[model samples]
Target: MANDTKIFHESWYRIANEKLCLRSSVKVHRQLFRGARWYVLSDPFNNQFYRLRPEAYEFVIRLGLDRTVEEVWMEMISAAPESAPGQEEVINLLVQLYQSNLLHYEMPPDSAKLFDRYKNKKQRIMKSNLLNIMFFRIPLFDPDSFLKNILPLIRLIMNPLGAILWLTVVGSAIKIVIDRFAEVSVQTQGIINPSNLFLLYIAMLLVKTFHEFGHAFAVRRFGGEVHIIGVMFLLFSPVPYMDATAAWAFRNKWQRILVGAAGMITEIFVAALAVFVWANTSGGLLHSLAYNMMFVASLSTVVFNINPLLRYDGYYMLSDWLDIPNLHTKATQQLTHLVEKYAFGYKRSTSQAYSLKEAFWLAIFGVLSGIYKLIVFASIIFFIADRFLLAGIIMALICCITWIIVPLVKLIKYLSSSPKLERIRLRAITVVSILLLFVVGFFYYFPFPNSFRASGVLKASEYFVVNSKVSGYVKKIEIEPGSQVSAGQPLIILENKEIDLQINEAMASLQESYAMRQLALAERPEDLATVEARIQAIQTRLDRLQHDREELVVKAEISGVWVVGNVADYLGMWIRRGAPIGQIINESAYYFASVIPEVHTSRIFDNEVKRASVKLVGQADTEVPVFRYVKIPMEQTILPSAALGWKAGGDVPIDPNDAQGVHSTEPFYEVRAYLDNNNGMKMFHGRTGKIRFELTSEPLLRQWWRSFRQLVQKRYHY
Candidate 1:
């Protein structure tokens, strides 16, 4: 067994003055990321070692006294003489033995001191506990590790992980705050136009920044490095983050913890300050903006960063707090053991290295962590429920099966792979696959509905589901579906028992009262005032009964016919009270219209409005004469007739989305004009003509703004 192991061992080392001197067969490779260089060395078949990180070197210094002869298998190589002049690098020190031409005693003492300075000048590296970890646990204090460890970290001076991270967090957070306030400032009390879930959104965004910045600046100040601050899209929403991997040399527990909490600390400060200012201010856009800013920063962090269920800020914090080598590995092992014991119901007859107590604790933590994960994952799924939920379910199912099946198969084949990385890589690949599938499948599966050019005909009519005031059966269908009618046109006749009863009761009372008035007047002409009062009561009763009967007749309030509803459904068909029999449009004056939902706009322009040809309903199919858009005040209607029907001149309504510099209308207003008709026929009362109102000939700046607004609205809603 020893002989077989020796073949893969591939190295032999001897110690001199507690420093390792090695003679090995391991091969090596060197590389760079931008200007930063790194090296890799390994046994021929397995046990790959990657060094060049300052942390690895620090590990060598701190743990060097305990390494066996076999562990001294690698060294970091650099082209430059990293140390100051007259000092030898670690590479030169370790490899000096290979240089055969050497004179030890013959060399001058000064020369010897220069050669020895490489090891002699060794600075005692200190490792501090990360402030971030402490704050994560306590959350009340600032993360001071970033500032304290900056100079101590030999490598971090050049890398800005800590700075980059916190700065990114601050920037992202500020942006979110600004955007939130910009919106909140626009709305006031009693204003119905503000955004929905506006406050929640603000809070969530603020938290995102705090969490991200905690990572970035933590790395920078903790002796790690960072660069970019960005927003990542998980299905639909934006999540901000900063890269902070520079603090590895800051091996102290405190430094790592500080980096973790830096962002959170900043978030706390910003949130607290924001609220303080908000409370002192009066109600306005500014105050609303402040409140939203603070709220977003604080809550988002608590909900997102405090849960150690995933390999994020919270996870790292938990790992440090628990003193675990790897949280994920422990979870995985416990899960496997759980399966073995509960699923297979196996009895352990063999002794294992893990004690029962440790296993018990691991099991408990694992289950709790699993529950946390369930909640977090559920939240993520819900957040992106629109398109990603289906994909998440399928991917999760596949992953569960893979976790069970692949690990067993991998035991022999890729057994050398690190368990810590396997699950992470699996998740990365799954996310990538899901995103890729969305990209390809979205275009293939969800084909857009047919689009028509937008007709200038803007919808300016209020809709009502006309209900019958009286219970009735259709006695007449004077106006058919899509037919125009007068306001007083008889829509239907009801078999109204209640209305008839009311009329009869009212008529009998009216007759009695009138008879009493006649008797009173004849009895005493001097009491004429009393007789007049009786007469007035009779007249009121008669008038009320007549009005009730007229209401049962069901006349059209406005002129247009059932353009959208069917009266035929009510024809000879019984209707109950408040049953919507049909709808009607004004005949002499009508507003051309279409509806545009927030989701899709291109469809409106391409399919309905731009390539539109207007014609009165029942007109011939020839192209209508196009007319330029005329800006007119809303609420004005251009009726086709005057004394016979409605007037020819009326005001028009403007589109709500379009802004008019002049506050012409109170509340909300629209700009519309007399709808023109051109389908080779004249426009008539109750006829709908597709109007092509040129809102703007969007080009240059206008075109760009439109595109920009649309992009923001569709993806960001800001």
Candidate 2:
């Protein structure tokens, strides 16, 4: 017998004399886990599978109508004494097999217990479905027959040649996207537009359909059956899914891994095909639909499927690669094991991990997955609530109940009533109570660094808008755009033939008037006053014409960077009077103009700002110090710069009605933080960045409550 095996269990006498055998309908398959042989008991009727180690499998096979369970156990111990399972292990094995309907009892009345077990299993499944309301599934039909019919075709594509083709197509599609990256990026901003929602849903459906089919084909190609094809309501949106778990029975771990990754591979291929369609077509329903398909495929595969932290395709692949079956469940159990064994000081508590290395991985994965799940859940809730408040509220409530309330209730029950904690119950209770209190107190009392960030653009403290004083055509650009120029330097020269001609005519008239004035003075002293008046009028007109002609040359109003749009495009283009040609900013003086959400305005207004800093995009290391700030109390929808809107790749939500994208959808308070001039930082006008306001330290719970209150007030006006 193995040294680690328990000699006997107290409950062994109850099932010692019972005769049981493996059900005829349940098929057994051999597989390897972590280089150890394991037998998989597959129940064909229910499509359920269970794994059993060699020692347990031998004992199970020994069971028959004539032999008692104790006799079978004795035989198992005699055959493989070193690796035989203990009596407690035997009891657990039998209970699990009976619950799974993989065992049949000789006594007919014992069948009632089996029936009850099956009913309980069904009820548990129903409860699980209810808890996972956001991801509920409804089985539609069996796809085994359909998969068999398409097996040959699947084999043809699930090969090396198909892989080569996939690479070629996907590579070309990537190149196409890279070539027009800017246009594609701009188009992506409207992906969730109300007008395009229907098309987006359709594209998502198509991509997911192909993705499921890919799994089905892979399973069939690897000699596995895919029976259940269903619609999974992912966040209340129906998407097709298939049962590809039969691949778990495959002996080759690589085959199982391949099956897990097939869905994502298929999605990428679909995205590539959609990219081609989008690139080839112009503006139309087809082009838009293709773009949506590309978006859906890439988003689903990357953010959801390929993320190893989530229990999706990538997670399963990682599990198979690491030879960890039921990784999530085991990792969760490992966490519990740590709490009970170490935290509660329960020495008898068993670990779910097989080795120290595995325990470390399980611990790390468990913590990371839990955190990621919370982030994803919160993000989903916010996203849904932003669109549908009532639906989001309902989902949040249900998820809180299932994820938080239920687990807490279970933990309390375990601490109070579990038999294993009988000896250390008091200590365990005290430890858990302290932990709970610590967590609550920490959140409610501990002061954390409080700050809020807003997207802003750099602006000059004082700037001059260079405007044409007189209407004229631009003849030359004396100073290039983006060049530094001194004040009064000629920036552009304008030509106006009409103004020049007027000046010449006025001069000629003045000369003629002077000659007439002199002649009048000599011939008739009475006509001298009229001639003098005529000469004065002509001289005034000539002076005005000369001034207008001189105004044709535009000069810089300030000594700063000459910022203008395409100087070459403006050459020969007629500019009207008072039209803005360019802006000459005082580069030495700068300020950051940031828009604060109306809800968050109270934080800045009520509290004295401790400090503020600006971090420009692509220059994260440089912190520009803010000396003074000016807050515009009035809420306005106008953005200081278009770069702070969605259309310009900024984080602010823009108003669709405003074509220029400089208008925001919601009203915000504009805050201008004057930057330090002596910081040796060259700030550019309209350069977008984030400005963080350091406020008084506040507790996280208080901050959260304040945010929630503000959210309700802003969203519901309550």
Candidate 3:
């Protein structure tokens, strides 16, 4: 039920439920009149709200109006012996109510109008605050505004996408292909490197940015401003993001639909043009453009941008055409109606939306959708001293939870009071409690804390994985199976007889010197001096021998993934230093890896650590567990290498605009996010799942927005 008061805490709600008795000295706003303790009241029956100030209460009691219109209407139709309900009386009552509504509407600047005006002003203030929240006072995402925000030098960049936006996507791809295949002429060394594909990919991203511009352009043709344009991530994958919330404000539904369709149309046209140019052209420039064009145009914009089920241009497209105020709302309403019809056997109507299907969907998802929106709002509102505001939110949430639970609680109380109806009440309470729990759990916890749970592979450090250096015949390997070793631990011993003999000779010399010194104790000058010299020489020999002994030890230089191998153990086996042998990998190594095409790479944001979850296979099946990255990779690889591992990089997607020129020709960027469930795999590598990365979305002005929308729709509601 909708309430249009300033605010009410959980305590007021408890008072409404009689969980906490109303206080006589409550600091309620008072006027010259009688009073009743009604801090807030929810009219769920009609999904309407009434603000009862002291004066309103006084007016009601003074008029002795014992019945509201809804109550009067009910009374006339009630099957009571005392009540007379003839056709004439029913018609008269209906006429009277209509007359009353007409009178209420006619009164100039009446209470409702004044209330609405006050609400409108409140909305204006709220809107201003929200605009500031998103980091601007007036959030106008016009073309001029965009150009102004971009660097002066960047203005040199052609918005070729604007002319034929998707064509750029196609053109870039074909250009890259032809450049690669049409035989590299004796020219710049830089042109030959495959790593150059990364640049083409970046160009594709620039094109997609204009793809959003196409959407904005269409929307602006009507009146509303485009407030936002940027990359969007759903799950963790990137998508060219844009905010078209402004389009809905237009009077015509067709305008909204046109705005939704604009981007896809633009992308398609661009992709087609790129294909055409590639097919017809034969010059070096043309060949390069044509080769890359088709892939970029089709891959980025076609496959990625048109998936309505995935929440991109497609989602808005469907939402606009269906005439749903919001697709998300409609989805929830539709589910809610399903639950009501099948689950509840067609019981309740939904508070939001037009039809049962819409309401049902919404109701089914009401708890989840509400929480999701709240979290998205939290992301945007984080700077609004959100923690302090969250307390208020928590209180408000508790009040809603209590409202949902009240019916079941009352039913339980009734069942306890009367044993005969216990079974019926029990069934009713069970269903109600289950439904209520859905809402309660949403408030308590579900998506908020767990939203960012994700994981990826950890790579070995460069020092950790080392091949055998200075190898000899495998005399003895020091480490045993399953043994853990520290850095510099002895792991192997090479046969070196010369070093062994030196050690023995040094020991013998030391012993001989000691005996001679004992024997020459009395010889003061010449004999004693000679003995001292001999002792010093022996000590030096021993030191050199020990230093040589270190070479034979073959110690482990680093700690990590140790690759154990069975080798040929023979006395005369040939060996070379820094040659092929068993490998060692650093257990604590890390790297970032991914296989993203050029189009999607454009959407990769820097410095924003997206959530990831890594999974490993195991013997026993278990619930999916998510993991977090220890650290973001310091450097991205220029060309795929073994040091980077798998050409795939550490499960971290290397946005390869530089590597994959194919995507540069696309009109829109496509990002794929892989989140792993690492809970079950103890003895295996990471397992992953697909996440539909969504860039965060929001209404420009969130606070009390639906409240204003409701006010407008109320005028039109029959």
Whose lDDT is greatest here? Answer: 2
Steric overlap count per candidate = 83, 0, 83
Candidate 3 colliding pairs, count = 83
How much does each candidate deviate from the true structure in C-alpha RMSD? Answer: 21.1, 4.7, 21.4
List model 3 lDDT by residue over 377-449, tens digit each. Answer: 4443332222245543454454344434554565567546643234354554567688778766655444332
Better of 2 and 3 by lDDT: 2
Q: Which ten residues in a row have the lowest lDDT in candidate 2?
A: 108-117
The residue-level lDDT of candidate 1 at 459 comes to 37
Cα lDDT tens digits for candidate 2, 456-548: 999888888899999999999999888889988999999999998888888888888888888887898899998888888888888887887
lDDT of each: 0.47, 0.88, 0.45
| Residue-level lDDT for 163 in candidate 1 | 56
Candidate 1 accuracy as lDDT: 0.47
List candidate 2 stretches off by more than 4 Å.
1-7, 75-81, 107-119, 179-190, 193-195, 275-289, 457-499, 509-541, 552-592, 614-627, 637-665, 674-689, 711-718
Cα lDDT of model 2 overall?
A: 0.88
